[model samples]
Target: MKFPLRLKFFVFASLLAVAPLVLVAQNLTRLTRDELRSAANEELTTVATQLRTEFDSTFRGRWLTPLMVIRNAIDSDALGVSQKISLLTLGLEELPQVVALQLSVQGSDLPILVTNESFSKRLVQNGLDPIETLTTSDDLISAIEGTGQFGRPLIAQISETGDWLATLALPLTSTIAGRQVTMAAKIDLSVLGQLVKRHPFAQRGEITVIDHAGRRVLGEQVELLTTRSIVSSALPLIVAGARADALEPYTRPDGSAMLGAYAFPDWFPWAVITELSEASAYAVSNAITRQILVVGLVGFAIASLGAMIFARQLTQPILSIGQVAERVRHGDFTARVENIRTGDEIADLARRFNQMIAQLGQRLELMKFVSEGTISAIRKADQDGISRGGERSSVSVIFTDIRGYTEFSERVAPEVVIEALNCYFEVQTGIVNRHHGDIDKFIGDALVAVFEGPDKEQRAVTCGVEITEAMTSLLEEYPEYNLHVGIGVASGEVVKGAIGARNRMDFTVLGSTVNLSARLCSKAAPEQVLVDQATMKAGQSKADLQFNQLAPIMLKGYSDPVQTYSALRHIQP
Candidate 1:
């Protein structure tokens, strides 16, 4: 406490007199809080579990069967485009919640969209057209792109009515009339409100759906809930969705308390949360402890003023440092404790900590510009620092490039082109990381990734297959973007090293394996993955895909044609 001798003595005497009574009051408060918390947990668990089951039954199983059948019928070449439309119309009847169905082809600006008769009339009443307005609407565009859902159950909200809708697009493996075809359906999510209304717990508490971000996806709040208060306090527990107990009671601004519990569905990103508003019943416990605390307050009144002064002076700077550290931990490196003026060892510690943080921030910022593989190499380098030298190491290299980006970019706006590229990279990067590969570099629309260790070839081939499939899905789901990818994988020896000017250096791998991969990528068709003989042999056991032998690939550097194998993008069964 840094207390002077006389002040310490005075404070000690005062605390000694009040200690017994303060202990009694604290014990009562603890006991009361625990009892109330336990009861709330048991009740909340039962409610949350029941709601979770109801949600699974209502939402998860409603779409797939009919959608899959419709998808298959569209793929059948026996059906003409009008016949396909007729089948889709019938499928719409089969799934009443699905309000609209749309069929679009790659590289086309217009699409065929069909809606239920009532919704079509509603569109007309709103001065809209099923073909023109809904086709060009932002929400429909987001749904086609599957913005939040990745590929299925694509969700977007109608701004005009504040209603949510989801889309599920089924793409044809065989192109119709030389153009790739996709069938999409818009599902009304107001069904969520209907589902929740059936729950009898409404009079006791509120039960609703929320996203991972704590936004009310669907609840009593019409459309998306803009209010941040109702369940935001319990959002972390809601997202975790692993606990079976209720939240500790939290008080609202009006002083009424709430108990909360949440459960997640296995098939969806949303969670179900139930909250009950209740009166706090701790008044009896407080009343019983009131007299004891009153006696203690008098005995400690003389020391309270000095204690508060000491705590404020001593702990405020420490608290600021702690807060900044917390922000730093969460990636806000800009936060700093700049107000410390203690002028003691604590102040010195704060100064050094800020300097250390600044240096770390600079290093981390630089790290993003380089490949993760390069970073790994640097980390494993000798402590004395890397020399301008290289070592031979075996690695599997996978190279990918966007197949028709030049034409796509020429036709699309520059910003739109960038957004499209980012989408492709995001999908490819996650696939690479999951397969234990590290990105080597991104050269314009081309990406190079490296995988090491015993299973490098298998990992590289699997990563390439995933990238092809992911890109295929992204393009097929939103064929409006009209882009595709070609990937190639090769496994061989390469020179790995840090080499450049003394002032600037880069860690990279260089060999025929890298060149071979690039050449195969250039020769690959859109949505195709080509692998060298070594990589293909090494990856024969990869269950996600199997290699199909390709014709010999002749390139500039090699006298003999290089043998290659391929894996096509996943075809939905």
Candidate 2:
């Protein structure tokens, strides 16, 4: 069977598109897998470092406590063997990691005392005397003499009856008896194994801890302690002050390929190793590849069928209209359908839609221009009350003026002055909007705004505090420009509307309230927020605000003195 020319072309185009999509899918999956693997390795290294630090700190504390107590006992001749035994018992009770404490004379073959009863019983059961076990070991004797001369603790690693032990030996000098003694504390290595068991690896990964000799100290395998680590070759490098963390591929004991990250912690004689099977690590990439193949096949079949059905109905005019609509959606309002003359309903529909879109675009542009030039609330009110003059409403009026702005502008260039002013205004405008207020206008370096609502007084006060804070931050960014503002707030009735000549008009609030606010602003000090008594009383219910009443003062336009208050506290949003 033969297919139509369009049908053949459709099948070929679908194959072309699906080929690149399938390749991209596979590449993206591979890249994501590599990134995830790297992140996992880094996280494992961090965890290992933290665990090693915690263990070293705990071990040092356990070792040093008994050494200090024994030295104190030797300095006082009043502390005999019985008194020393009491101090050792107290040290053992406090340090959970210390299994036993022993005291012996330097170069002696017997211990003067042993604190742990369990350890004494264990020595007897194993046919070893407690004194001989403490004195006959060459490691213990060497550690004692070395620590006495150098004032450092020595750790001796030993295994007894399938259990690992670390004994810390320190030397104490008797000022009274004029002799040197050894104080030793034994710590159980099984605690490290238990700690490793508590923090398991992710998925099927494994964690291992190895001693300085590259002998496994703790791991998932019970036999690990008896075998040397496979990465023992790296131990010399670590001892020579090389970095502890590395990524390399190796084969596990089970003959499975694996990727591992190893780290040797600082100030500790141990290495942490983390490993994951290579097959498991690549499982996600494999699954993504299979999914991409299946999806490409299904998408190609669907595209071929869809092309066959739509090939005949798709015309030039329809394509042109679709293109125009897409451009309009992306904010290209100038786009229009061209050469759409089919003499059918589709052609007429395209013409009418184009006209509608053009008209909408013009209206939106005009609205945006007006909104940017004036306060949004006043613009809305002007549209609603264009026919009428204005409306009378009870509102709170706020006025803020930059102090010393005139002198500052005279000192700087025009561009610098404009830039600094614009930045300051931008911050203040946002503050007004957030407090449910509308900016009336900016006159020189001054701003006029109005707030209308049940909470108008509180909103205006909060706006003043925020504006002061915003200006302080702005001055920090532009340190060359020294700028500050003073704010005044008053509450009363006002006529709000667009006022001025027909060609050029401004939306503003006009009343005695506006005059009082402006006058108070002129009288305010730098960074001060002054409010009329009425506004302070209205916002008195706000618990977070602080107000102090000022003496009544006469204004330029008022016959009676106006009672006012200063907003003393600044609250953060």
**Top model number, TM-score:** 1
If scored against the real structure, what TM-score would every candidate get? 0.46, 0.43
Provide the lDDT at 486 for model 1. Answer: 91
lDDT of 2 at 564: 83
Q: Which stretch of 10 consecutive residues in model 1 shows the poorest summed lDDT? A: 219-228
Task: Compose the digit string of candidate 1's lDDT tens values, residues 60-151.
Answer: 57775677778887888777889888988888888888888877776677676778888767777767665663453434544655655423
Residue 560 in candidate 1 has what lDDT? 95
Candidate 1 structure, TM-score to reference = 0.46
Q: Report, for every candidate in turn, its global Cα lDDT versus the true structure.
A: 0.75, 0.72
Clashing pairs in 1: none
